[model samples]
Structure formats: C-alpha cells, structure tokens
Target: MALNKKPVKGMKDILPEEMQIRDYAISVIKETYGKFGFTSIETPCAESIANLTSKQGGDNEKLLFKVLKRGEKLDVAGAASEEDVVDFGLRYDLTVPLVRYYSAHSAQLPSPFKALQIGNVWRADNPQRGRYRQFMQCDIDILGEASNLAEIELILATTTTLGKLGFKGFEIRINDRRLLKAMAAYSGFPEEAYDSVFITLDKMDKIGPEGVKTELLENGFGESCVERYLELYQGLEKAEDGVAYLADMLKGVAETSVTDNLREIIDSVQATKTAGFEMVFDATLVRGMSYYTGTIFEIAIPEFGGSCGGGGRYDAMVGKFTGKEVPACGFSIGFERIIMLLLENGFQIPDRPKKIACLVEKGVEGQALCDVIAKAQAMRETGSQVLVVRMNKNKKFQKEQLMAEGYAEFEEFYKEGLRN
Candidate 1:
C-alpha cells in the first residue's frame, strides 16, 4: 500500500504561510510576557498518567491520549485494566505539567515564580474550526503568589500581548468560582449539586436561559433554585455594574473579599491596560477546569464568536503533587485559534526586514556565483532577508512564488552583469 501523505486525524501539517504567523506570534508572546518578568520554561509533552488523571483537569482528563507500557513492561494480553498496561499520557494542557514542574523545582526557583511556557498539547477531542486534537498552547503562570496582584498582572500581560498581535476591542469576561458557588448556594442548591448546576449554566450561551432552566429542572433540581439562580442573571442585565450587584447580592453567602478582589482586578486592568479590550463581570462564566478556586476569565473575540482562550486561579493544585498547597494561576492563549484568525484576516508582520530574492542562472558558477553570494551576505548583514537560489527556467513563475513568500525585490544573475 502507498504511504499516506496526509497527517493523522485532528492533526495538521502547518504550511509555510501559517508557520510564518505562528513564529511571529510566538516571538511577540515571549517578548511581551518577558517584559512582565516571566521567565521561559519547558516541560515534557508526556506526563505520568497518575498526575494527568488527578481530577484537577476536569473534562480534559477524559480526553487524555494514554501511552501504553513499553517493551518488557507491555502486558496488554494479560492486563486486567488500562492501568495495568498504560503508564503515561500526552499532556492535555500546560497547567498540569507546570504544577508538577513547580513541585519538583520549587527549592531552586524564586518565590512567586512567573513562567512562560509554549508547547503542543494533545486531547482526543472532536476537531472543529480552530480546535484540534493536537495543538499548541501558550501559557503564562505565576506560582507562590497569594494576592490579587497575580490576577491583575496576568490580565494585563495577556491583554498586552494580544494587543501587540493586532487584536483589538476584545472582551475579557471575568468571573469567580467562589461567586458561582455562592450564587448556587444562595439559590438553595445543595453543595454537592453546584457542579451540576454549573455544568448547565455553562451552556447558557448556547442553549439560552430557558434551555438552562429546562436542563436544570430535568436534572431533578428544584424549580425554585433554578428560578432564583437565573434571576441573578436577569438582574445583571439591568445593573450598570454586574460585579457590584453580585457583591451586594452574595454579601453574606460568599466572602466579601472574593467579590471585592474581583472588582478590583477589573478596575485595575481597565485603568492601566494598554490594549483595546473591555473587562466585564460575567457571573455565568464557569471555566471547565474544576481546579480553578478563585477568579476565572475567558477572552472573547467578536470574530471567533467563542472563547479564544482563558485561565484562572488554582491555589490547591500543587498540593496534589506535594503535601502542601501553593498558590498558582495561569492564562493560556488559544494559539491555534489565534493563528487561524490572523490568517483569515490576512494579517501582516509589522516592521519585518525587507525580503529580497537572488536567483542565479543555472550553470553560472566560479567568481560570478561568488560575487552573488558576497552581495547576498552583505545585504543580510545590513538587516535584509535574502534568499539565494538557482534560477528556474520558468523565471516569471518562480518570481511569482517568491513574491507570495514576501520576497518583493528580486535580482537575477547570468554570465553577463546582474539585472534587477
């Protein structure tokens, strides 16, 4: 059988055009985050199955791509369960591996370590427009910081990076896990049922309030709880400031500080942000990750009509690896999605070096080639991007292709003098 040339399902071969944007975006991300004191770090793409399934990743754990035992350890025929045969899995996201990395390196790293990690993650999810089973995730996380400063800095850094990438007028929809629980609690939901209620509430954008109500009622929740739970959303629509309204409503049910801290984060970002984005309180926002203990946020771009990326505070996740809790929070950009949007919009890299192509006539060697090579090198040293290649017979078509690759100026060399 002929070898298949296509990539496996849910994966893709990035073409040169898209790779250019991806490379530029990564440079911008690293430069912007680095300015905010985040140091670059790396972790293995594969992690132990035990840590991946520690219940911190929520729905992503279900989508893990497990790796079977290797060589002598392989006992698929005699294994009674998956655990008996599988030992590791591809990381579903960066946060889990980051926490594990921090647990092992905390002794040598600085307190409140800020890390910038960019890598591929795998999930056996249904591939869609911008989502792939295998895709890149760009994450910035801060560990060992117990104050709202972490949240504030994270929001500012992420938004500034997006703005540098030419994203504007986007929405940073903010919410708190505590507020979600507090709303459910005040609405008379059982403590154990908060997750179930949240699972339905998360669908509000898709199914609408009536759909959420029907689902909640069908799931055996009290109609009164559903009514009261949704009533808060109704009030939020009319309130000038939803965060203040929620703060007042959840006064005694939730801690005063949770709402206060969240409000302060929104105000701080709005006041100091150098980006063209809005920070709005979204009580209905429930980041799927159960590990998020406090402020949760998602970036909404009007073009995507869905979340571009998101993250939140997960103070207790490190405790699962070590015995003691450490404060941690992260924000991940939907890397693949951002690349897709930029490609769709025909985005161009700003201030790029002038690209020039030098095509040498076939069989033109000796000092003529040496002169051409010397000229290209000199141009490169002067900050020009030069591509030197043997001239193709189809010179016009070759120039057209080179032009598409951002090579606007071209020089042709033959036995005679060079022609531009």
Candidate 2:
C-alpha cells in the first residue's frame, strides 16, 4: 500500500556530496577532451533492439534492458518470441549508439571526426561495488582514421585527463585482438574457437595463468594448445619486450602488421604521454567487445586493482551500419568506478570557490532581508558560493549541516545588527 522509497534494484540515487564529485569529474573530462579536438555529440538512450542485439557488443548484448512494444504494437499475449514483443532497448554502452549516430550523420560531419560523448547507459546487470545497472560512460572516439595515430591520440588524451584529475601511477594496459587470435592460432587453436578461448583468457587477472589453462583445457581445447598458449604469457613476464617476442613467435601464424601496429601504439604513447602512468603491453588484456578488430586497451589503476576504463579499435563497427568500411577507435573512462575510488579516498575538488553562508534570523525585517540578499549577491559576483537562508531555531545545528556541505564561513544577520 506504501509507495516504494528505494530505487529499483541495481540503480542508485546520487546524493549531493557524490553529485559534486561527479560534476567536477565530468567538467574535467569534457574540458580536457575538448582541447584534443573531440567535438561533443549526443545520442538517444534507447536504440532499436535489432541494432543493440547485432552481436557487436559481445556479452553486453545479453544484459540489455529491453523496451516492450507500444500500445498498438503490443501483442505480448500472442507473441511467439521476444522479438515479437520488444522493439527497442536502452543502450548498454556508448559505442553502439555512436556508430549508429555517425552512420546517419556522416555526410554532414567532417572526415576523421573526433567525437566526445558523455552519457548514461543501462544494462540489466547484477549490481556490485563500483558497478550499477545504470552508470555514466565518457567516451572519445576517432572515426575514419586507419593508422595507429588514433590509438596514440586516444591514449594520450585519456591519460592527460586522468593526470589533470590527480590520478597518478595508473597503467594503461594495451593489447590487440589480432595478437590474441595469433597466439591462439600459433598454439593450434581453430579460428572458430578464438572467441571462446579469449572469453576464458579475459579472466587471467582473477583466475591467473594456471586457472586460464585449466579452464581452456576443460572447455575441450587441446592440452598442448593450452600449454603453448599460456607459455606466451610466461615468456612475456620474462621478456624484455613482450610485443617484439610475440611478433617473432607468431610471425608466420599471424600478420606481422598486428604486432607492428601494437608496438607503434605502445612506443608512441610512452614517448608522448603527459600523465604519470605507464603504457604496458598486456598480453592477457582481451577487451570484451566483439567489434574490436585491432588494438584493445584498458585503464588499470593500482588503487582499484582493476580496470577503470578502456577502449580499442572497432574498425568494423561503422561498416555494419553503412555497408562501407571506416576505421574507428575509441577510449572510454570508467566514470562510475573512478568516482567511487575518488570518494573512497576522500578526493576533494581543488581550487573550489570560497563558500560563505548568510544566515538571517526569523525576525529580520523586509529591508534587513533585502540588505542581506544584496550582500550575498555581491559575494556571488565576486566568485564566492553564498547560501542565504532563514536562521533555524537551533542555529548551531544548522551551521553544522552547512559545514558538512562545504560551507565554512558564516554570517548571521539579526534585525538589530550583524551577529558574531
């Protein structure tokens, strides 16, 4: 009989404190990305179910929040399948919608467009720490650029933005889908089994190398293939240059261009990065996107002990929309997770405007109130945050609440005069 006060399962209501941090993070992201020539764009939250389930989003397609047909279109009772009932779904990530956006607007857009998008995405996922069914994603993508320049600029821009936000000593773990496939092929795995193999491989951090080996073998892969595949990882741990080693090891099995491109991206980012971070060649990094045709990467924060954000080359995605190929690469910041870490570590916004609270007693007359308001307005014009409110019966408690909201200086105006 009572209305539910709680949010739906897996979603959250952001409070003022968290909202402050979220706002600041978004500003820094937008400002930093804007300097890199990424023009901001927007796309609708809901997308056609057909496009969302086009098999490009990998496992994320399974987590889509499907939207049912409308009144006239609704035939749920007579529907034979989900397709007959659902027509659209809330987008699970920005990339899919972005590709669709580009497809429709390419004629009006510039060549090699650098686009920046920040928005909420929904997934019917099991909520956990640092994860929610609805969360914000900050993505910057370069379309129509085939060379590794796109990768270099993305890594640089993302890392620089992180640095500006006071993130230090994070790792940008880079890999290539081609390299993943090459390693598997060199180990005698069939092309068809690459996806399943990489699915297990993506858990290397949790399951460890031995765990990955066991899972691979248990999945009916050849024991020799498993050993040979994992040996590459072991070799990487010892090799001075993992990319070079892979380039030579998988030379005949895979294209030399894959390794060369990956190597170029790593070398270029390392040479030009402005952030206090490392550009690592992580052989185990298998970003969970079926559309990623080339280099894949993730942001690894030491404090979080997991990926904070990541993106990769999805050269084939736009082709799906237009039937013509276009080279595209993107990087997305793990916005919610980063905010969680910042909140957990008590990250305060630097250089915040001075906060002053103007508390007027209840009996303060019309002229007195106008004078107090005028004074607060003057303070606001001078770049201060002024909160003018009627003084409560318990002034101390009111001030305490204001203090918690970052209001430090207080001015109490009584009908008679200013109170100390």
Candidate 3:
C-alpha cells in the first residue's frame, strides 16, 4: 500500500508564493492592530467539546471536527452516542477560545483588554474557492469595555488594515441585534419568535424582500406582522439617512440608546476613518450568532461579491463560562478570502526587500563556496532577500522559476571564477 502524499480533503498545501503573501499580510495585520493598542494573544487550536458546542459559535458549531478519546478511553464498543467517545474538538472560530482565555486569565490582564489573535481554525465543511476546512482567522477583540468606543475602535482598526491591504470602496454594513428585535416587536412579532423571524430576514439579500415575506408567512407568522415588518425595510431604502429613520421609527419599541449608540458608531467612523469605504446602516443584517447581545456588522467587498468577514458584540459569552458577564466585541477578517482576492488582483507587497539569486556551478567548492556563502550572508544582513543554490542542469528553467518567485537579479558563479 502506498502512502498518500496529498493533504486531506478541504485542506491545502500552501506554496512559497502564497505563503509569502500570507506572511506579508499577517505582518500588516499585527503592525496595524498593534498601533491601536491590541496585544497579540494565542489559544490552542483544540478546545474542549463542551466549549466548542456552547452554541455561541452559531452555524460553526455544526461543523466542528470532534476528536475522539484516545487509547484506553476510546470505549468504541460501549459508546452509544458521539458524546460517549469524543472528548475534544477542533475550534471552528477564535472567539470561543478567546473567551475561555479571558475567563482563565482576566486576573492578570488589564481592564478593557484589547487583543489581536491570529491562528488556524478548522471546520469540517465542504471546501470551495477562498474557503477550506482548515484556514487562518485574524481577529481583534476588546473585552471589558462597555462603551461604544469598543465598536468604533474595532471598525477603524479593521478598515485601516483592509485599506492598507489595498481594499477600497468596500462597505461596512452595520446593524444592531437590538434593532432587529425592536423592529420585529414593533411589527407585532412575539419576543420568542425573533430568532425564527431573523432566520428568514437573514435571507433578504439572497431571497429579496418578497421572498422574506413569503417565508415569514409560510412559517406561520401573521400577514399583518409580515407586512409591517417589511414596510420598515422599504422605508429605510427611500430615507436619506437609514439609521436616523430607523431610530425615529423604532423610538418606543427599541431602546433609544441602542440606536443612538449605533448612530454614534457610524458617525464616528465616518468622521475619523482613514479608509475609503461606506459605513452603511443595514436593517436586515442578521448575524446568525445567537449570542450577539448588541451591535453586529459585516464587511462586504464588491470584488468578493460576498461577505469577507464580520462580527458583533457577544456580551454574554464569557458569562456562560465564568458566571460573570463582560462586555466584549470582535472583528474577524477572513484571512484566506483576503489572500485569495489579493492573489487574484495581483497585489504586491509594497516596498519589499530586493530579491536576488546566486546560482553556483556544481563543481565550485572549497574557498569558492565559502565566498558565495559569505556574500549571501552580507546581502541578507543589508536587508536583502538572497537565495543561493547550486546551478541546475536546466539553468534556463531554474532562472524562470526564480524570476517567478520575484528574483530580479541573478549571479552565476562558475569554476573559472574560483581560479580567477
């Protein structure tokens, strides 16, 4: 039997070219997020099954890759259910681990701790372009800050990072979970039915308003409720200021402070943002996470034709772990999708160090080899990217490959050069 060399399904082997771009993007994320006072943190990729299944991860929980018990603990024959065998699972996102981290380490961390987390997450789902079962996630979160300042800083920092990566004219579609509940309540929906109603509303972009109406009605909601529910959406489209209009419409139904905080976030980001993007008030934006207790937002890039990343305030998640609720908000950038877009758009790393290659003939050895090594080290010390390799028999092909890897200059060292 032959051993398989290929990676598992939905996983990929990253080549040097893509890795280069990924590394550059990571550097940018760390640098930009650090400027905003976010300290880098790390959590393990594997989390306890209990934490992964805590229902805070939204749809991702369904995609968890559960790890079975090992060796003597396996008990396969006696296992009657998955829970009987599985003890841990690969994390589907970073937020759950982050919360656990905070719950465990809050004593040592500062108040209003700002965190920058970047790591690989796994989801056992079908793979597609710009998505994989295993991929990197980049997140910046603020914990212990109850003010709208958290949301504002997250928006500014995330957009600034995107802008630095050459993303322009993107839309940060913002919404509040409270607003969704208020609108539903004002439309006569039962408080308990908000989740079901939101499930349909989330399909608005894909199914349109009429489709949402049809689904809501088919789901046993009253027609009057559906009619009044969609009317808010129609009015928002025609209003010059969607956020203001919604604020006025839901004045009594939703807390004035909820919409007020939302408006402030939009206004603040617009006033002080360095990125070229629109901060849109999307009434129908239903982030699927059930744990979102307040504002929710997503990043939509015209180039991707879909959401590139999103997050919201999950104020209750930590409480589930420690019995103490802390105000928290996070923004995650789809690292793989961002890389895909950059690769497709031929994005280059700005101000990259000079890349040069030294191809030495195979026969060149002894003091000559030492000279080549010394020269390469010197070039590297001066902040240049240097590649030294033996000359290939197919030298032209090797040079072409090197050129593709961004080697702009090449030096050929021959045996005669040693004599010289």
Return the TM-score for each candidate structure: 0.98, 0.97, 0.97
Q: Can you tell me which runs of candidate 2 are displaced by over 4 Å?
A: 417-420
lDDT of 2: 0.92
lDDT winner between candidates 1 and 3: 1
Q: Enumerate clash totals for all models, in the order shown.
A: 0, 0, 0
Tens-digit lDDT track for model 3 on 196-281? Answer: 99999999999999999999999999999999999999999999998889889988888889988998999999999998999998
> Model 1, which residues run further than 4 Å from truth?
416-420
* Best lDDT among the predictions, by candidate number: 1
lDDT of 3: 0.94
Query: Considering TM-score, where higher is better, how would the candidates rank from best to worst?
Result: 1, 3, 2
Query: Whole-model Cα lDDT per candidate?
Result: 0.94, 0.92, 0.94
